[model samples]
Target: MSDLAKDAASMAKGSAGLRGAPHHTAKPLHDFKAASHDLSALGALGSLLKATGDIRDGMNTLSALTESLSEEWNAEAKLLGEVSDAFDLLDVLLSAAARAKKG
Candidate 1:
């Protein structure tokens, strides 16, 4: 092909490529991206709230157990049980923080 013809063909190809791009036609990709980001934030927040609620419930259980054990003079057993409860709560808190940070 002649140089002029080659130039015209290349320009046509470039224009065709641009036409296929979503940005050139204002596709809904921008809105979808925003919605996806919002959903992710909501999910993270939900996870954190759930984890905190779980920890609070567990603490309440531990406190009640401790009070009962104290009346029976079972301090050693209560200490072990409370240690397990503490670890479980820590696990929830750390998992929640990690999931939130990932988002």
Candidate 2:
């Protein structure tokens, strides 16, 4: 009776159910074929192309902005030079007036 009980306990420990073994299906070939069809390389190339185009566009925009800023700076510098010349003329006139008043 103890020998039969040991056999029954061993069978129960090894089996998924009281009498049945575990069942598992194999991976289908079609699943492997689908997994092998990767487009990550093409996706990376596409992203690289888009980034290059964007960088080119940004460089163009920066060049235009730099040129515009240069023009604005030149205009401001010219205005400052004109104001300086006018101040010089005013100083000369004031000095002449002072000399005439002393005479």
Candidate 3:
């Protein structure tokens, strides 16, 4: 198989693994002042923010990778576009969660 095909297959397998992973819901902090006094809640918020940044970074990397691929790779472009869309949706959801937690 071509290297591109191999890489795509590997990405697909990784995606499948993500699909089966357990979900985690962050506890919403309605009051920033109250949450600031709680060490555990602060820690959780920090973790959530860090995760959101990481996801954004991953999305950027994927976009760069897609841009570097040849124009003839239409199938790969379509696949990467779907992946990018998912990342965008996730980013929006995370942003909303962060905002809700702040309020």
- How many residue pairs clash in all the candidates, one count each? 0, 0, 0
Q: Candidate 1, overall lDDT? A: 0.51
Identify the candidate with maximal lDDT: 1
Model 3 agreement with the true structure over 17-84: per-residue lDDT tens digits: 44433221112222332333444533566576676455446555654454444232545545755665
Which scores better on lDDT, 1 or 3?
Answer: 1
Cα lDDT computed for each candidate against the true fold: 0.51, 0.48, 0.50
On the 0 to 100 scale, the lDDT of residue 21 in model 2 is 16
lDDT of 2 by residue, 1-103 (tens): 3343444444434332312211111133334333334434446664666664554465556555655655565565555555545555666676788899999
For model 1, residues 1-103, the per-residue Cα lDDT tens digits are 4343444455555544443443432335335433433434446665776764554465556555644544444444344455545555666676788899999
Shift of residue 50 alpha carbon in model 1, Å: 19
Between prediction 1 and prediction 3, the one with superior TM-score is 3
Sliding window of 10 residues with minimal summed lDDT for model 1: 18-27
Looking at candidate 1, what is the lDDT of residue 54? 56
Of candidate 3, the 10-residue stretch with the lowest lDDT total is 21-30
